[model samples]
Each structure stands twice: as C-alpha cells, then as structure tokens.
Target: MKPELENIPLVKNEEKKRFEIELNSHFAFIDYKETSQQISLIHTEAEPELAGTGAAAAVVEKSLIYIEESGKKLLPFCPYVFAYIKKNPEWKRIVDQRFEGYDKL
Candidate 1:
C-alpha cells in the first residue's frame, strides 16, 4: 500500500556524507556511495505514534530526488523501501541496477 506522506522534512549534511530527517525526534538516513552513484537504505524507524504515517516514504522520496539530481541509483536494502518501490512503479528508473532480489517480493 502507498503511504500517507506528509510534513516530511528531508535534510542532508553532505559534509557527513549522509542525508536524514526527523520523525517525532527520531531520525532516519540513507547510506550511500557517491562514486558508484548508489544509495543503500540503511535503516528507518519512527515513534509508535508515527507508525504507518508515511514518514518512511517521505524520506525515501526525498532521497530519490537527490539520486535523480545526482544521476545515481538506489539500493533499497531496507524492506520498507523495497515495498515502496513495488507500490510506486513510476520510481522504477531510480532503482538500483542490482535489484534483482526485489522481483521475488
């Protein structure tokens, strides 16, 4: 199912080589490799109250925009991200080249 994305704040600290956001004070970020132009979704979690609020999708969407702008691909290691890709076929283009594993899910 597509998530109910809202009020998401995407932030990046390039100096730290990471991009992140706050969901009820808890943070999430995507682990990436600049040279290979690949991003691995490292982790994501929200306060119990924020669960199912689409905070994960919002963070992923923002990161995808960054990938598109940087001419890179995404490695959705996190299961939530993998599921998001399945729901949003339009975002297939930015999917990582090695995403063969997702076809089974």
Candidate 2:
C-alpha cells in the first residue's frame, strides 16, 4: 500500500553533511553524508497523535524518493527506515546497508 505523498508533507533542507526532513512538525530527519556511498538515515519520530497511523512510514517513503531522485545511496540507520525497506522491495535498489539484521537491500 503506497502512502499518499500529498498527505505526507516533507521539507528537505541541509545541515553540513546532513539532509533533514520534518514531518507533521513531530518528526525530524538527519541524512548523513560521505559514508560508504550511502545516505544514512537518522532521527524519525511521530507526534503521539500521529503514531501507529503510518506517518513515519510516509516520511520514510518521501525521504527515499528524494534520495533516489538525487541519485544517492541509502543506509537506513533509523529503525523505521530499516523496517520500511524490508517490506518494500521497490526501494531495495537504493539501499546500501540494512539495519536490524536485514541486509538484503
């Protein structure tokens, strides 16, 4: 099930080697730079009200799209990102390293 991008708002900005996104004003993202040809995911949190509603997943998807479009590799460090990639095969090509023992991507 693909989450709607419009419903899941994303803002991408950079801080040094990190690219970040804020989701629903509840979550913050940090994308690492210069790491094994990968984008390291960091910081993902949903507001209490948005939890269990797939808001985090939506953010991950949006972030993934941004990374893919930018032609960078992904190294999912955040637990949410790790899990999302595991369940979604279409995103596999972008992943360079997997977390939580999931290394296939």
Candidate 3:
C-alpha cells in the first residue's frame, strides 16, 4: 500500500545536505548540494522495506517544494529525481536550464 504523503514530515538536514522523511520504521532521503543560485538533487533512496510505498517520492516532492519556496533553481542530478521531474513537468519551471539535459536521462 502507498503511504500518505501528507502525513510524512520532511526534514531538511542542511549539515548532511539531504532532505529526509521517516517512514515505516526507516528513513528515506534525497541528498543535495546548494549554492546561492541552485540546489542540486544528487541522490535519493528509501529503506529497502519502504520501496514501492511512495516514501522516496514523498521526500523528493517535499524537497522540491522547499527548493521552490527558497527561490533556487533545481539541478536534478540523481537519475530518480531527473525522472520524477520529467514526468512532473510543472516542476520544470524551477529547474536550472544548465541541467535541462536531465530531462533526457
């Protein structure tokens, strides 16, 4: 069964450069690097048991929302994140043009 995204609390762990969400007794997270101009999402993973439950997507979505609110362009370097944005083109608005190639990945 899919988890309720609204119930997951996404946390931005700046010191670790990742956004995390606790789920099903495990943690899902998206690693990123931020600069004044952009925030690059580099990796994303969910605990093995959380697979297929939308935990990864929940964290990624929340991270994107945070990046949007912060007004920084997004650089989706992680394959998963790139694929996510490609499917959710509305997020293209916040993506950095330099990494637009991610759409093709």
Per-prediction TM-score to the true structure, in the order listed: 0.69, 0.67, 0.89
What's the ranking of the predictions by lDDT, best on top? 3, 1, 2
The alpha-carbon lDDT assigned to residue 93 of candidate 2 equals 81
Tens digits of lDDT, candidate 1, 23-74: 6677656654455767676555554565766665677778878778878777
Tell me the spans in candidate 1 whose CA falls farther than 4 Å from its real position: 1-8, 14-18, 23-28, 31-34
lDDT preference between candidates 1 and 2, better one: 1
Q: Candidate 3 lDDT (Cα, whole model)?
A: 0.86
- Best-fitting candidate, measured by TM-score? 3
Model 3 lDDT per residue over 2-71, tens place: 4567777789998988899997789999999889989999999999998778888888889999899999
Candidate 2's displacement at residue 86, Å, is: 0.7
Model 1 residue 81 CA deviation in Å:
0.4
Which tens-of-lDDT digit does each residue in 1-105 have in candidate 2?
A: 234434555666654444434454565444555454557787666667666666666667778887898788877777777778778888888876444454554
Clashing pairs in 1: none
- Candidate 1 lDDT at 18 equals 65
Off by over 4 Å in 2: 1-8, 15-37, 97-105
* CA error at residue 18 for candidate 3, angstroms: 0.7
Q: Which ten residues in a row have the lowest lDDT in candidate 3?
A: 1-10
